[model samples]
Target: MFVNKAYRFRLYPNKKQEVLIAKTIGCSRFVFNRFLSLWNESYQTTGKGLSFNFCSSQLTQLKKELEWLKEVDSHALQSSLKNLADSFDRYFKKQNEAPRFKNKRNNVQSYTTNIEKKNQNPEVSIAENRLKLPKLGWIRFANCREVKGRILNATIRKSPSGRYFVSLLVETEVKEIPKTASTVGIDVGLKDFAILSNGKVYKNPKFFRALEEKLAKAQRILSRRQRLAIQQKRPLSEAKNVQKQRIKVARIHEQVVHARTNYLQKISTEIIKNHDIIGIEDLQVSNMIKNRKLAKAISEVSWSEFRTMLEYKAKWYGRQVIAVDPRHTSQKCHSCGHTAKENRQTQAAFICVSCGHSENADINASRNIHELAILL
Candidate 1:
């Protein structure tokens, strides 16, 4: 079996190339926002949303209306905006929800569409290895990894840590591989990010909690500096100091993301490496956060991120990730197959009222997940 994968490459460029890349990203963002504004207006009047094709066509026409865009690259501009339209379409379809706003395209991320035929001139084989774009021309990109197979599509986006990445969808020949292990289920919690079917528990390090104290201090400092600069009615140059402080705050957020992402990858990789099938509950995190007392801790743990990490990792490792309904996972008794509300006495204790079997709440939930994976 084959899969669609995203590989991040770190770009290294001189000052000039960096400026060009930034400008190109800006142009793409501008187009996205413009389309979003126009689409929203259209929706307001017609009570119907603009189709993906509609937005893409308008975006292409609008670009020609921009004189400066003539110098950059038309292909890149259309590709980026078309990507925005495609993403919104996918989001609405996947979530069974409606799109109402055009998302803000930040930095380093642009999109190209996947038409019927593949791009014969692969990214690796692009002119000057810079990848020519409309208006932007051939801007530099990271070539750390080569693109293989027929390129179906590509998306470039920036992380909060200010890094550029590309996700590629390619058509490849299916390669048969022997299965190494059996299927398993996973339970995720705030206390321990994951509990596996094999009785393995991953402790929630609370990486954000560790840096909370320092983060609070930095935010206070940043706020004070920001207010002082504003009260002084300082010139644009004075704002530079405030900007520096803001960057410091951004760096802290970046650190938190890096640490969390790394931890999730390591844990998910280990799980996928050992199991051919992985099952986890389809938790309603939004509802769970309604608990006022647990909201802070729940957000800190980031269960959703863990699940997302598990999904792609499992795919990469040739494992199946199953998301069972979250309802009653904790209350269900693995021993007697009794699922009742009374089975769970407290947050950490599980005692089946029907079967009289007692166990750790998390463990019982993990077992239930495992059973569900097998059944699925």
Candidate 2:
């Protein structure tokens, strides 16, 4: 079956390429913001925003008038306009909040450019450790895996920790695996990352908490540097010591993110490969986070990220993932269908008052989720 997928890799650009990339990112952001302003002005004055075609046509004039804009990839500029248009469309549909202007200080820089298909030349290709883009030419990247199929577009981004990455969107086909009879349910928690219906538990790595002390120390040093800079009447951005400490703090957070992502990817792949049908709670994480007491633990566990990984991996592996209602999964007795506050004897134990049944709380929840999935 055909599947649209994205593969991301770290980029190692030379000094000249880095300059060009920075220019391209800046120009893309400028074009997007400028057009957004025009769109708003037109909407207020004429009750309608500029059409995509109209915006593109104006961009041609803009590039001609602004010589610096001509130095970057023209396709990237156009893509910026398309992104703004798409964002506004989503806003109108109430699917997302309105788009905001991109700020350089935000510490996240990115631009998207599409690969053109021509009769004589392919727009994108990979050779060894190099990747060819529209205007950037061959740039070195860590080729962790071979990219297959037609390349549609790519988004290049620079993180706060001064790392560059490129996400390549590709159109490819994947063969579905043979059906398996095995099925399982999962209950996610803070003590353990996940508890399976079959009584297996995946321990929470707690990456952030593990690095919290180091992070706090780095931040404290950064704060001291900032205070010194302020006393000297200089902007924090211009303070050398402050900048160095900021990077130190950022790297710690980056490590945490990488560790969590790696763990989720590994566990999700294992679950998808082992089971044909996977059931999980349909957790309202946003509402759940409102409870300030549990928010930190919830965020650290990264349940949303885990669920997202499971869903996408399930599709790729030819497995089924079902979201069961979370209402009484923890409180309900799996053996007798009795559900009440008294059923949960403690955080870790469940003893059904009506049926006198006993089980691990998380395991019981997983069993209830499994039954719900089977019914669904």
Candidate 3:
């Protein structure tokens, strides 16, 4: 089956290339913000937003008037317009909030450029340790893995930690793995990342909590630097110390994210490979996090990210991932089909009053989820 996948790599550009990258990001941001303003104005006057075709046609004229816009990659600017259009589309569909103006001071900045194929040869290709871009030419990047499939586009991003990375989106064929004929249900919790119907538990690593103290210390120093910059009547960006400390704090957060992502990837892959039908709770995490006491714990568990990984990986491996209604999963008795608040005597244990059956709380929940998936 054909699938779209993204391969991300660390980029190490030369001083000139870095400057050009910064320029491209700035130009892209400028185009998006400018077009967004026009879209808002058009909507206000005519009760209709500017269409992609109209905005795209106007971009040519805009570049002509703003000579600096012509300095960066034109494809990047067009991509920026496309992204703005997508944002509006999502907003109108009530899938996201309304599009907002891009700020230059944002911690993370990115620009996407389309890949052109000439005589069946793609302009964007990885050669040895370098990647070819539109106007930036070949730039060095960490060649950690072989990039397969046809390259569609490349997105260059600068992280808050002041690190440059590139994400290449490609279309490729993925062969499904051999079916294992195993079915499993997973219940995710703060204590354990997941508990399978087979009574197996994947412990939550708590990556953020592990590094919270260190991150807090770094952030405290950064806060002091920011206050010092303000006291001196200087912009935080202009203060070298503030910038350095900011990067340090960003790096700590980055480390936590990387660690959590790595763990989730491994676990998701294992589950996908072992089970033909995987059942999981359909958790409304956004609403769950509204409880201030559980917000940090829920965020640290990263259930959404884990579920996303499982779903995409399942599709790639020809496995079915079913999300069952989470309501009463923990409180319901797996053996007797009894569901009541009293059934959940404790956080870790469940005892059905109807049949006097007992089981681990998460295990009972997973079994209920498994049965629900079978019914579906």
Candidate 4:
């Protein structure tokens, strides 16, 4: 089987290379915004926006008019226009919000460049501790693992935490794992990260909550620095202290994200390794977050991320993941097939009103999901 996979690695660039990276990202952003503006203007004037081909052809003239644009990778500039075209297509199809101009401050700093193909192989290559891109030469990177297969494209991005990384999209042949003998059901919650039908519970790490104090302190310092910059009538970007504080704040948030991702990946891998069929509730997280009382807890739990990890890992491991309807899964009595609101006696307890069956609420819900998955 053929599969497309992405691997990300930390990049260490020299001063000159760093400057070039910033210029490339800036040029890509400028190109995207310019094309978006032209698309909107043309649509309002002629009732039709420019197509990808039209915009791509026009980019040649744009590069000639702006010498700074030529300093960056040409393919990366074309990819920016392609991104804008995709955004517009999604907006027209009602799949997403309309395309907006990229802002230097809030927008993500990244650009994509596709690898040229030769003899059915990509031109990009990785050496001992370096990876080569189109315009940017070989860059030193942390060699965590070997990259396999044909490199299709690469996206280089600078995180808000002021860390540079690159994600390589590669196409490879898939090898499935041996089938497992076990199946399991999972119930996810804010209190516990997950409760399994097999009576195992993974405690919620609450990574954000754990680091909230540090983050709040950093934000306070950042706010104070911003105020000082305003008092001095200088641009906030020109203020060294403000920039330093901003990075500090960003680092705290990045720590939280990294912690959560690590925790989720470990548990998801464990589940996929143990089970051939994994059943989980089809949670409507967006609707659930509407509860103001639980929004923070729900968001911190990141059920969506957990589910996404399970799904992709299942596919990679040659397992099956089933999402069962969550309605009344907790209230239903797993022992007697009795379902009622009163069956859930409390937050953590489930007792059937009809059959007097009792069990842990989350465990019972997970069992119901498992049964439902089997029936489906």
Candidate 5:
């Protein structure tokens, strides 16, 4: 099976190289926005959309027109154009969703270059790490993870902190493990993200809560400087301060994201390894958030991220995951198959009205999930 994996590489460049990196990232964003504008215009006027190749040719024409465009390397420019075209292709494939206009935001985009076809191996030496592009010269990145499979593409990016990193996508074959005999079910909640059927309760790390105060402080500082800058007719000092504030906020956000991602990775790896078939409740986050009492706690969680982790890790481990309707997972008595609204009293205890069976509320729900999975 082909798996999508990302490997990060650290970059150390001189002042001149840093400028080039900034320009390259900016140029790529410009190209993406320019192409998006053309695409929407074409759709509005001719009622016929352009293909990836056609959009790419337009970018090449525009590149030739700009004097400073020559400063960026040629291959990099072409790669940027290609990446934009691919973005459109993927967007249009999900035509039901409305495509948003590309903004000049930091994440507006980074740059991508095909690595697998050009480089025989990712473990290439630093001397060979240099990648040539349209206006950019040979840029090199030291090896990190062993490029076990052919690299599909590598993206070059300048993070909000003004740091640069490259993310690599590789294609490789993995053997599926023989079927395992164990199965498990998990019930997720606000306090503990999940409670397993075997009476194991996993607490919710609440990644967002840990960073909430810091983010709030950063936002306040950002707003103060932003307001002053607007009032002062865009003072350079204010502009610089605002940029600093934005980076501070972005750093905290990134840390929280990494922590959450790490937690989910650990949980998913455990779930996939020991279980052949896993069952979980299909939670409607939006609907569940209506409870004003728990909204603060609910907002801190990333249940959807957890679900995604389970899905991909399960695939990696040659296991399967099934999400069943969450209708009575909490109220239903696993022992007697009795579901009653009154069975749940407070947040901790579940007492079956019909069977008089009592259990820890979340644990009972998880047990019910396991029971339902075994039935299937």
Candidate 6:
């Protein structure tokens, strides 16, 4: 079956190409913010937002008026409008909050542009260590893996540390892996990343916690630099020392993110490869994070991201990922079906008050999840 996949790579552009990239990113942000303002005003006056076609026509006229907008790739500007329309659609559907204006001061910036398919040889093609983008010509990239499938579009991003990257979305056929015909349930927790019904536990690496002290030190230095810039009446963006310190702080956070993502990817891949049906708790992480005491720990655990990885990986492997109701999963006795708060004697141990059943709390919870999935 055909699946849409994104392949990301580190981009290394020349000075000229970098300038063009910056211009494209700025123009794209400007277009998005301009139309977003218009959308809000239109909705206030007419009880409706501007249509995509209307915005597109306005962009055409805007380009004519502002010649600088014509300097970058026109497709990128159009993509900005499309993104604005999508934001409004999502807002109307209550999928997300209303769209906000793009900020120039944001550490990360990105712009999307589509590939023209009129010619056999498209502008957005990957070759020996280089990716050719619209208007930016051929820029070298870290070709870590062979890119496969038909390229659709590319999203170019400038990271907080001033590094450039590109994500190429492509359509490709993926074959399901041979299943093990085994079923398993997963209980996710702060102590362990995941506890399986088979009594196996994946330890939480706590990448952020491990580096929290170092990150705090870097951030403190960054704050000092920002204060110095302000004392000298210089903009933080123009202050070289402040910018350098900011990049240092950003790199620390980036390291934590990379480590966490890698760990989650490996764990998710391993689970998807071994199981035919996987049951997990439907955790409302957003609501759970409202507890200020556990908010940092919860965010560090990244339960939502792990679940997302499991779901997509399961789909790719033709496996079933069922999310069962989490209520009483931990408190219920797996062996005797005795449900009570007293059953969970502690965070790590479970003992049934009535039936005298005993087990690891997480493992018992996972077993309950497994039983629920089967019943469902």
Write out the backbone clash pairs for model 2: none
The digit string of per-residue lDDT tens for model 3 on 177-283 reads 99888999999999998999998899998999899999999989999989989999998879999989988999999999999998999999999999999999999
- Cα lDDT listed for each candidate: 0.70, 0.92, 0.92, 0.90, 0.75, 0.92
For each candidate, what TM-score against the reference? 0.77, 0.97, 0.96, 0.96, 0.86, 0.96
Over 54-163, each residue of candidate 4 has an lDDT whose tens digit, in order, gives 99989999888989899988889989988999998999999999999888887358989988666765557788998888878888999899888778899999988778
Q: Write down the worst ten-residue block by lDDT for model 4.
A: 116-125
Give each model's clash number: 8, 0, 0, 0, 13, 0
For model 5, state the Cα shift of residue 51 in Å: 1.9
Once model 4 is optimally superposed onto the true structure by TM-score, how far is the C-alpha of residue 19 displaced, in angstroms? 0.7
The digit string of per-residue lDDT tens for model 6 on 296-315 reads 99999899999999999888
The regions of model 6 sitting more than 4 angstroms off are: none
Candidate 2, residues 163-212, lDDT tens digits: the string is 89999998888877777689999999999999999999999989999999
Question: Model 1 over residues 1-376: C-alpha lDDT tens digits?
Answer: 5665555555444576556556656666677667767777886999866776776677667757886655443455676556556666787679545444434433225544342244454433344355533233355676666665665655555554455555556665434335876788888888787887678899998888888899899889888888888789875345977767666777788788779888888887777777888889998889999999999898877888888887876666567888998888888899998889999899889998997999788988998999988898
- Give candidate 2 regions above 4 Å deviation: none
Select the stronger candidate by TM-score from 1 and 4: 4
The superposed Cα distance between candidate 2 and the true structure at residue 70, in angstroms, equals 0.7
